[model samples]
Target: MSSAQYARIKLGNQDKISFLSNLGTLLAAGIPLLDAVGSLLEDSKGGQKKVMETLRADLMQGKRIYASLSRFPRAFDKITVNLIRAAEEAGTLEVTLKDLRDHLQQEIEFNDKVRFALLYPLIILFVFIGVMLMMLVLVVPKLTTVFYQLGVTLPLSTRILIFASDLLIKKTFYVIGVGGALAFISYFIYSHKKSFVLNILFSLPLISQLVRQIDLARLSRSLYLLLSSGLPITVALELSAQVVMREQTAKMINRSREMVLSGKKLSEGFRTSKKSLPTIMTRLIEAGEKSGSLDKSFQEISNFLSYQVANSLKTITVLVEPVMLVGIGLAVGTMMMAIIGPIYGLVGQVKFR
Candidate 1:
């Protein structure tokens, strides 16, 4: 099989979640590590089976579980590998596995919610585009013929509509090809220049806040997980930066990490290095530091940011629905009035024999 085909068979996020949960449960039930892996291998298939076999063989050769897992970078990220390494040394593998499983599950749920939140706006845009296409292709052409037959002076709006309809009808293939090319170009730009696109997003008012909060939430959650798994604050911050979506947010986190590395307090580093860092986060971290519970502080921050994100998503959905409906209503209404106006005038000008 090609490398790409081989890659496809690797464990996905859900599969990894299941693996972790099952392994954690078996370990908690007092099963030996080797036996737990062996039992899991019975029902495993494809890449998972291959992984389990390798793990079992490695364990037989006296390799540690984390060492075996570190080999599958595609299946287990750096954060997972490092956490498992900590767990093995700390003798908390079962707890760490369950915690990791829950963390991954939470990430999946949050991502699904984010997708669902944005789904409405995309649906509205596509529906609006479809309405425009229908008007241009079907409705406007018939109206154009009527207006021509009546010999009435067409208003500017109607004339514009007619011109658009004519172009759409006469150069349909060209229009479609251009649209497809534009879409492809747009996708390419977004994929290659994600940071640039994200920068633009961060400049927008409403969306910027939402996007930032989402990234912050993810960063905080990652930090909480890493810290809970016994990673150092600086290391946690570095790994957390890698997981965030916004380049700007990641940069800010990295800056904080650098400051923290220089023997600065985590809260002080965040407050100094990140100008737009929320004051609440700074205060909470400071407090948590004083109490030696920085991980709990991050968990609290994650919860707060998640709440705000949920509210923001709800507000967007509530506002977008009415705005889209009203905008579409006005557009269609104006077009109908323009089409009907000239015909109405022509009917009135007709004289009885």
Candidate 2:
């Protein structure tokens, strides 16, 4: 992947989460920081081991964990590092790490579910493409030979198929080159054109809702974590924006931050933002503000959105699987008919003669 690709990737790493979870456990067991680091270092290997050793060295030099973590921004995002800094200062490192561990676990699980849900469709698509290519490049050529040998006037469909097969078999390198270039250009455009990508994403039907729910879930959970860590609301909102994946959602968050500074409540800003996030979110935020429990309210909203994300993904999987299968079947059936029908016609003419 290019640097732009890495820049656009979601925050958090599974290995970092495992490390945080284990570190928290060790800390809770009353182990000194140095010994814990050493033990972890002993068990580590490869690039992760190198990072751990650097961290251990930093600790040995009397630097803080968050300070060391800040050096590796790719692995530990600003939100995670700040949370650890706050926990370190407030003397709640164990609890903070555990909370972070839980957050990372949820992120990992969500990503895994999405990958699995999409995997089936992708596999089917690849298989369909493979079968189609084989028929076009291999099967169609043989039929084309037979039709030419018999001097039969091929149907329009067969002629089209023959033309396509000629392109596949004769212009093979040109096709591959064009495909490779398209893939690269697509990646570049998608990574750089944030607003374009967001607009396209939100224009889709089911996908639009799914994207919004997932973004809302992430933002709510981020706010809950940051606010619960004793950060000011403004700071929390700013940091929470960085944790979300969508560019438009991040822009809305920044807009809400500006609104908060101009004497508007966070709930009002959330309600009035361009996206118009769920009404229930604003209602609960209002209630939480009145009761001085915004953290809990945000957590509840996060939980609800998480469930919605899962349900929406399941619904998409259920609908798309059958549609894809039917589409493949129809495509293959059409191609077979196109290739075979002319041969049958030629055979009948021969028998009549």
Candidate 3:
């Protein structure tokens, strides 16, 4: 059974890369695959060691490395397994493992760039929310009690804040219950593709751009690796399409793959896929086609796209932090004005009377 057919345990990406790199190095040094697994087990601990030991047992049973690795779906994802399969068939398992390591490293780099870009703004947002919530829950009630005793005529903004504070303080359990239920329902429906939220998110301009770039980079990199490992163009496209998380990009690729099947050029397929694919990408693919160096072309395209994604992430971070900060500032300023401005007006009225 393939690893996908068996129960698999998820391995950390860094750990997976380390193990694969070690295995590749050992294989290059003329060790048998079985001995390589044993060597990996010696240096490994915890879940990684267990995964290697399982592979060693499977290797002892005369299974090909790819087939045995495939059985652990958690340890080896489909892309890794397929690349290994192609490499094994082509007698390039060692080189394939090295390539796989490089592929994963690039992926990690891309993801880290994106994650770091969003992390600062998200943290700021959370801190803003927490501070606001605490003030509403703790400070608002006491100040409101003083206003009530003093017979101060509260403004509409103050009334709204008071109501919100009541909701958070008096109905805390109900608020939690409703929020938790809504979150769970949303996640379930969205994950199952039954939620309009998913469709809406995919259609947003900023999200759409980021998704397309990321998916394109991954698709090109995967195709390059699979093709370099001797996989057919059709299979490479098919497998890589599955790795592209964006529905639109995956659809574009599948359409392009069908075009390739129907004897149409892949570049033309991408250009006309009804998605906003970049002209430069289409031109690169055309160049690859013309030069009869499609794999090399894909590598270049992937590298270029990776650079673009990093730049996009940097741009997004630069733009979003300031915008988010301004919004938070406005929100906090409005809240303070609403709460304290009325009190000032009331004090003026008392002096006049």
Candidate 4:
């Protein structure tokens, strides 16, 4: 691959996990790092192949592994780089690699669960919209002509349906163009104004709570890994801050890091900042500090927060399913009433012949 292609080639989670697991196993078995990376070339393909080749080349040139990994920011984030660097410095590469693989696997599974939980509601909404649009364009106009031909007053619901059907059929291109433009604009704003969008999300009830728990879970998990790998507390906090998505949570972590550097206890910093942190986390950290097992405390906190996030996702899925079903039922009932109400009125006016 060319330099530009190499720069653009980002590996997926599974690829990184496989790379770490294999490399760690080889190193544990007393294989040299350079030879292990070279051996991985037998199975590597595409971007992963490029990555392994580059790493082997870097190692041959006497550059550190972490330095080579830092070149691929998209594939290896800052947190991964720092952890590996710490491992290399402290002679714990095998252990850190194993931890990294397990961490990545957990992250992937949790992300998949969250995505699957939300997918059902989105599918239902899109299906409902598609069915409604088909009825408006294909079915409503035909029934509207019959209602007007009866020479009797139509109900308000029928009139509204006719108006909508006429608009869709007559201004189809205009509607489509406007809709496409709006969708593009919405996507642009959502991408470029993430903090603004997050602010809106934070104002929501269920969504805000879910967002908080997910970010906390990520932060705690990252801190646990970084601290357990022999990283300094402030450095661990700083790296953990980058792993969370919420702007507020990241700022709070950064503030906590500053406080830790100023000689305050980590839990004291967390408790004092308290911008977006929960009391439970601070309390756990305090207890962990007193017992001289802060890393273990973060591990427990991560587990608890992850469980809460999973349960919250399940609860949301359950609640949204019934609400969306009732919404679809209401929409269908209105459409049925509009179409059938006029026919019932027309039948009553006819005399027996």
**Counted clashes in each candidate structure:** 0, 0, 5, 0
Off by over 4 Å in 4: 1-7, 149-152, 273-275, 351-353
What lDDT would each prediction earn against the true structure? 0.87, 0.85, 0.85, 0.89
Residue 16 Cα positional deviation in candidate 4, in Å, after optimal superposition: 1.5
lDDT tens readout by residue for model 2, 207-246: 8788788889989988999999988889999998887766
What's the TM-score of each model vs. the native? 0.88, 0.91, 0.92, 0.93
Per-residue lDDT over 4-66 for candidate 4, one digit per residue giving the tens place of the 0 to 100 score: 665688999889999999999999999999999999988999889988888999999999999
Cα lDDT of candidate 2 equals: 0.85
What digit string (tens of lDDT, one per residue) describes model 1 on residues 54-116? 889989999998887777768888899889999999999999999999999998999888899
Instruction: Write candidate 3's Cα lDDT for 93-125 as tens digits.
Output: 889899999989988888888888888988999
The TM-score obtained by model 2 is: 0.91
As a whole number from 0 to 100, the lDDT of residue 233 in candidate 2 is 89
Q: What's the C-alpha lDDT at position 93 in model 1?
A: 97
Off by over 4 Å in 1: 1-10, 46-62, 67-74, 351-353
Ranking by TM-score: 4, 3, 2, 1
